[model samples]
Target chain A: MKTAKISNPSIVLQLDGLTKKIGGKAIVDGLSFDIAKGEVVGLLGPNGAGKTTTMRMIVGLIGMTSGDVRICGQSVRTNFEQAISHVGGIIENPEFYPYMTGYDNLMQYKRMTAGVTEARIAEVTRLVGMQDALGKRVKAYSLGMRQRLGIAQALLHEPKLLILDEPTNGLDPAGIREMREYLKQIAEAEGIAILVSSHLLSEIELMCSRIVVIQEGKLVTIRSLGESETPTQKLLSISLQVGNAERAQELINLMEDITIARADALTNRITLQLRQDQIPGLVGKLSTAGVEIYRIEEVRETLEEEFMKLTGGNRIA
Target chain B: MRNFTGLLVNEWLKLSKKRSFFVAYAILAVVFGILAYAFYELSPDGLNSTVDFATGTIMLQAAGQLVPVLAVLAAAGSVTQEHRYGTIKFLLIRAQSRNKILASKYIISVVYTLTLVLTAAVLAVVAGYIVYGGGAGESTWSDFLTNIASLAVYSIVFVTMTFMIGILTKSNGASIGVGIFSMMVGSLLVMLLSRYTITKYLLFSNTDLSVYNGEGPPIEGMTMAFSIVILLVYMALFLSVSFAVFKKRDIA
Candidate 1:
């Protein structure tokens, strides 16, 4: 609905020590992160881990107790209208006037957003594949239809930053996939920075290029899914087929920080977990001990396993 | 200023399409229609009533009753319904300031009340013509205008209080409860306290400006100018609190 020339083109949103306190207790504590253009970042936490609170602060639904959220280089506290003009978001569930038609609901938002043309309304509805349902009242819409309409309105403004809390809350597998595709497509084609939060680890793994994990209202870790390495995430899975699987595993027992994930006697195969930098040493020691190494390949750990390790097995709801 | 008008248009469209609001207007229409029939059938030859029957019916019908209830429902919905449907999350996040949004809702609620009044005024005139046969009891347009102006002042006073309740309670049931309770008991309190000096300063006692031109003040000393100042003071108090709280409070 509004456009401003970004002085900082790369970073669309910046959270500097964002914190929110209620009743003398902190709900979100010292959280900091940055989202760049054409990037999809996920906020992963337990059910009450302040993910929703952080999203609210960014979109100005909830006032921050201390710290600030800067969107497109404008401070939310000092310049709210200019800062929020570049954002489009749905905090939890996308709610609208149920008695009104979907088209009328969209028109309500359109009228408040300056410079939005009627043609853009058509374009957004088409983009969400909701042209047929536009005439029907919103009460008749299924949850999935409302989610799509939510996305349509968020994109109607052509915002520089998009924030969604649990974007795939009630969608079926296929619908979730469709939402992911739409988000990725919008991010790439329109240069929009997107932030989606969910408690489902595997869901975040499949959708986001990077994830910011928070537990107990504090930053735990930030990891990139794009082949970037961090010390805490250096664990790797190695599968090797040798002449004697048991003997090869026994030989690697002397190596520190090495453990067997699985072993097969019939096929002479052993699956080992170790650090990425220690792979060559493990293979060298196994081959020098009169063992024939037929094949070795690295297997990536499932993101669920990594998330569990990072969050320390907090119940994700 | 343009942004404020745009918000007003949005509120008007939403309220007009609302079933509850539309039903309120429908009831108003039916009530006026029935009252016209009753006035005609009960009197055989024309009563030749001196009062402007059209204007009198509007004030007597709406003084502290239907108009206030309808206006309160509409006003309360501006806050409570938004929270109920979870639409306030989206509304509060817009580029417009919360002050502007609150101001728009205030004006729209008043506009809604005035529109209801205008409809009843028109219907009352028709009823006046049909029952009186346009011979004697028919009011001059100026008298009709004066009565409408008086009703407008009363509407402002009632609506300001109702909207302030909406802001304070932030719950549909609670706002309606307080609005109804106050309007219902306002006159009773005034009557009971009429013997005391403090009754002259009571809000309800000063609200009925029609006392100046018609029945005179129930309290001995209240004048038209004094009532205007009192109304302005209360409006300022209610509106300042609304803007201050709305601008700073968390929407979550």
Candidate 2:
């Protein structure tokens, strides 16, 4: 996969060596990342892994103990009003005046973002599929509807940088898919930089072009889709035509190049990862020994597996 | 300055959206209406006590006074409500300076207090005038209205003071409880102390609007000019303390 070089291209948001300490503990430790225009970056971390903290700093919600945040190359601490003018966000859960109609809530947000017009409000409501419920009070809406309205509110000004923290949280599978697709469309079509943080690995894999994984308040790895080669490991599923599955599996387990595990043997299949060279050797050895060779296929590690490996299986439920 | 005005409009809209505002208005209307009727029944004559009855009832009935308490309640919970609802982070993240946000809320809380208090005052005056056959083409009520304006400033001052305390405490229960208790209980405590000693500075000692009536010795050895200065100094102290504390608090 090819990678784009940084050549002074416009950066909509950047966090340089950001750190925050709360209750004498480091919540965000020397975190750094950047989002250029038209880029969608996923922030992946455990439940307590500082993704929210980083998002807060970028939006100027929480002042960093050290380091700096720049929106559209403007320092938040120095030119807060100017910097924040280009950014829009929804942190954690989107709260509204529960007694007011959804339209009134949107109007309130529009009032916050300068130059927001009724046409723009209508456009955003349509974008988030909330046009029909605009007249209903927010208290009457479901969580999914409220989340969509939150996104609509965030997009009211067509912000240059959009930050959403765990946006798909509490959404059903369909809602999650809808949110991911909507976010990708806006980021790509509108040339808006998006930074979304989530605990769901598969959701990030599906939406983001580049993924930043943070663990225990430190960045572990930054992976771009199809850029870095997945660790040179593949799961192989081998099946035998004859009903000598137990004996064959035992013999294969003795091999040094692979770790064989017993798979449900309705078809007498064994699953394991083997070296590329070991595959040719094993096939020859099996044929020569008169073992039935039904099929040999490699299963690539999914983003979920890679996430487990990168996070060392420290995910929270 | 335009940005500040825009923010003020937003804050005013938020205040109007709250149920407490309407509740406060309803209670004020009912209480003032009842007091208007009672004043007419107890006036010196059947139909000749228009201006006097209006002025007497406004002073006698605590009905309209609830506006200030409601104003304090509104100010007490305004910012703290955002903190509890986890929207302070969202609010602070917007393209507004911290001072602008504080100032907007401070101004809006005062405006809210003034609007409610003025409504109550109008109702009391109108009801009294109607029940007692109206003030007989006199300039006395006009001068009294001017006096009411000065008293209105005091109500505004108390509302702003309560707002600052609310922001400083960042807890609705604590701010509201302390604000009301200080207004009510602190006045009682000061009055008690004044009976035994030389210090006679009670909170309500300054709240009496008729001090300019030239009736009794001033409550705290404070002249009108000195009293206004003390109120200004008190406002500055509370506002500065609120800003200092809020600037240090961690956004939720």
Candidate 3:
């Protein structure tokens, strides 16, 4: 019930040894992370990895069995009002009173909260591009609109930390892109920290600056996205369609700074990972071996493969 | 206390937006109207005890029969629907604590119950006037004042019980089912068990505050003071269980 200590002055949210147990089982165990101002941190985990449970604990929607969640150095266990005062959150899918208009729904939030001005309301509505739809009843709204209105209400108070649980769960490709854009804009314009949870790394890769990977109710890794690597230092994976895959694999295996990642003799296709500078040499070696190279194209390491490496082969839902 | 008024206003707006409340109130209004018309048509001549009929029958039916059902729906729905729709998260994650939020809903449930009771009192007076003219039920005002007062004391206990049921069940259909079932069957069971000494301790037995106003206790040797004390004990039990569970439980 004490305030959690912050290691960095810029940190807006701190979770220290956060845990939740039900029926003598830990749903989220010993989970801890920090989100600093202006950073978009993604909570990445497979299905039932406890992403939703962790978010619920932080926002006080669910009580924690142990440890503390701190916002602006205020403990959620002891000082709930002040601790939650600095947080704006959406748990799971956004829900509202369906019979009320979106505007009235926002007004309901405005009334319960202090220091939320009419101008601030207008700004948040505009921020979400929901100004025109504000007068429409929530029952008449689509899922995407509900998500935006949920964000709109969360932003109305202008908290230092924003937590969104599965923000793009039901959106189409276009709506997902729009949501990602809005999140990026909010983080930059408001200069606040945001924690977004999702099971898909593709969504997180596009939206988050850093990723906190969780597996089986534990932290697997915390990695910064877009780690800066010079073109020479980076390894590129290239799939080569050749006349004989066996000949290409043998030739590529002998080359320096290049390794065969996958070789398929049936399709005569082999994927190789090597430095960008090694591509020309790899091609020359294959050609001299009289292995006809039909096609060679680079392949981005996909979400599945990235997660497989992190989780050691557990499937992400 | 920081935004208690805001919480009240929010809960009121929420209840006001519920279409069922409008449907319930409208149906009550139509039923009241029909009762007035039936009396007007049946008695071309004014009844001798029109004051007794209006307050005792009409007002009692409103407070006793109609108010419990509607008030239970409102009170139970006020708590259960938040859990159903998952808006409870939005309600709890703000600057307001759970205690203040629950207090606001409880207060509104009481306010809503009183409002329904008062509306019935007004409608009863109007119905009596339409049937027998203004001067016929002269004592109707004093009678209704006492009747509504007892009804308030009588129905407030149910409002609290229904609100607590909503918290316990966390489902509209379930809470309303149990609430109305408890009201109807609890009274029936009290009557069936009235000869037993333990019946005096039942909620339904003590809920009728009219015993203090000369209607007499449901059981022998039960005083007005005893009934009041019993009602207080039940209300305290209902409230403490609900508040404790709501404050301590994980919303998930």
Per DockQ, the best of the predicted structures is 3
Please write out the lDDT profile of model 3 over residues A1-317, one tens digit for every residue: 56547868888999899999889988889998889999999998878788888999999988999988989899998999998988999887889999999989999999888889899999999888999999989999999999999999889899999999988888888888999999999899989899999766788888889989898778889988876565786888889999998877777777777888888999998988888888788778878889998998988776658878888776643
Can you write out model 1's per-residue Cα lDDT over B1-252, one digit (the tens) per residue?
677788999888878877676788777778777777877678644345424567667774442246666776777677778888888888877788888888888888888888877876777777777767566665566666777776777766767776776666678788777777776788789999999978877787877676787788888888999988888887788788877777777876
Residue B226 of model 2 has an lDDT of: 59
TM-score against native, each model = 0.88, 0.86, 0.91
Residue A156 in candidate 3, Cα distance off native in Å: 1.1
Instruction: Evaluate residue B180 in candidate 2 and report its C-alpha lDDT on the 0 to 100 scale.
Output: 75
DockQ category of candidate 3: medium
Measured over the true interface residues after superposition, the C-alpha RMSD of each candidate is: 1.0, 1.7, 0.9
State the displacement of the C-alpha of residue A229, model 1, in Å, after optimal TM-score superposition: 10
Q: Cα deviation in Å at residue B36, candidate 3? A: 2.1
Candidates in descending lDDT order:
3, 1, 2
Q: State which candidate, 1 or 3, has the greater TM-score.
A: 3
Q: Model 3 — TM-score against the truth?
A: 0.91
Best by lDDT: 3
Q: In model 1, what is the error at residue B54, expressed in angstroms? A: 1.0
Evaluate residue B84 in candidate 1 and report its C-alpha lDDT on the 0 to 100 scale: 89
Report the backbone clash tally of model 1: 1
Residue lDDT tens for model 1, A100-191: 99999999888788988899999999998999999999999999999999998898878999999988888888888888899989998899
Q: Which stretches of candidate 1 lie over 4 Å from their true place?
A: A1-8, A228-235, A239-269, A273-299, A315-317, B44-51, B61-64, B138-141
The TM-score obtained by chain A of candidate 3 when compared with the true chain A: 0.88
